[model samples]
Target chain A: MRVLGVDPGLTRCGLGVVDGAPGRPLRMAAVGVVRTAADDGVGARLVAIERGIEAWLDEHRPEAVAVERVFSQHNVRTVMGTAQASAVAILCASRRGLPVHLHTPSEVKAAVTGSGRADKAQVGAMVTRLLRLDAPPKPADAADALALAICHIWRGTATGRLQQAVAAHAHPRG
Target chain B: MRVLGVDPGLTRCGLGVVDGAPGRPLRMAAVGVVRTAADDGVGARLVAIERGIEAWLDEHRPEAVAVERVFSQHNVRTVMGTAQASAVAILCASRRGLPVHLHTPSEVKAAVTGSGRADKAQVGAMVTRLLRLDAPPKPADAADALALAICHIWRGTATGRLQQAVAAHAHPRG
Candidate 1:
């Protein structure tokens, strides 16, 4: 199965795609971003995002999608913005008829590293090493997205039954 | 000043623009929707949204834009999808140098119906009567968008002194 992972943001969206098969290593398919100017209105910015997602979907036909869930933040304004970005990722996945899996920040961090409290840099370093990439992905968003994909690959595997069980329990109804 | 109100959704975004100057009665410059198919990916949907917003902005250069702020919902999946649509609205407004205002559902309800617990029909009825429109805005989303704009106009005016005072107190540092 091909899995696409996304980290959504108002200014930029990080995307990564990987092919996963039983007993085979997850192969990198694509990695990139969709961006819009900070000055655009909500309507216009959405257009840019939708278009970016459509193009990416067309290019790489992923069988499944995983997106980072929106975590609660202290700032209401930022939270609202992040929520909107989260919606875009979900919308994109659903529209394509691909089952979407949402991972919390802590879960992604734990999967990338050994600790749930791992920082972005630590997660990035781990992702680079695991994916056998020459260098860490550029822009924190992309690295995070790649990490999300890696997390899913590991969690979706038979060896990851413990983690998958916990994740499934967390999403009782989703 | 002309202000545009938007209610963003995964498949459709409701929009309404009103010219609210001192002497001029509120004029409905335009009201419509920007739509995208569920089958389309994020990028394609965003393009359609962007084009729609651009057309609206180009036709009616509203000075300010108002959008409804989405709060947490029980359904994580639904909230995630809606968030993307909201981001599109916010980004589009920001890009055009429009001073964006966000209105909570209760705030808009209260502004229109003198009560925060008003139903959609009640809010729609009041909006139609307040604006002296021939009928309630066709779709529920349209009325909601108009209500959002009205809430901003009502809250941003001299008559909204109480609200302004409350806002100031809420954010004393600002």
Candidate 2:
């Protein structure tokens, strides 16, 4: 299955796509950033981001999506912007009924580097090693996104049946 | 000068335009929602929104842009979506070299209704009264956007020069 993962930010959003089964080597399909100018107002930058995502989605057409859930941080301003970026990713996935899977940063770190507290460089190094790539993912956001997708494949493949059963049990009426 | 105002939302976005001068009534040159299907995914919906804004800009050639700054709400999901939508407006204005203005919800209400705590209905009524329109702006977002534009005109026209002076004083080198 091809999965798209996104690390969203107001100025630059990281996107990566992986195609393969769980535990098996996943091929990197594409990776890039959706960039917006700093001088542009938040609204305009968002539009540009959206446009970039559209182009990416058209090119890749991943079957599923994984995104990092926004966590509360001490900085209100940063939290606010992150939340907004998260919403954009969610909206993009939900609108298409793409079945979005959200992962916490720690979970992604653990899945990628076998440690919950791995730094960005650590995670990037592991991603490169695991993927057997010559170099680490250039942009931190792109590496993070790739890690998120890989993590989803690892976790989702194992618990796929359990989750389906739980969903059936919980939403029996629906 | 002409100013465009936008209120971004998930399903719909409110848009309005007004002549950017004192004593001019807020003109509803166009008022409508930017609709996106619930199943369309964020990328496609965003394209629709950009097309809507681009069309408006091309048609009106507004010299400035104004948007309502988002305030935190209990619904995290909604707030996030709104922020992305706001980003679209900001990018549109910034790319055109037109100064973009952001007004808080309270400030917009106070400017239009003389009370910061005014409800939506009250603000809608006041917008109609102030603009001397034949009817209330349809789809609350449109009215809210119009109010934001009006707020900018009221505040910016009087103090825009003063603000420039103060900014220059604070950053002499800049």
- lDDT tens digits, residue span B9-109, model 1: 76878899877754346667777788789897655665577668778888888888888877654355555445566676676677676878878889999
lDDT of 2 by residue, A41-142 (tens): 566766677677767778899888888877553355766666666666755666566777878899999988899999999999998987778999878988
- Look at candidate 2 and tell me the lDDT of residue B99: 84
Name the weakest run of 10 consecutive residues (lDDT summed) in model 1 chain B: B73-82
iRMSD for every model: 5.7, 4.6
Native-referenced TM-scores of chain A, all candidate models:
0.86, 0.90
What DockQ, on C-alphas, does every prediction get?
A: 0.24, 0.23
The list of candidate 2 runs beyond 4 A from truth reads A1-4, A15-19, A27-66, A71-75, A83-129, A133-142, A152-174, B167-174
Compute the lDDT for candidate 2.
0.78
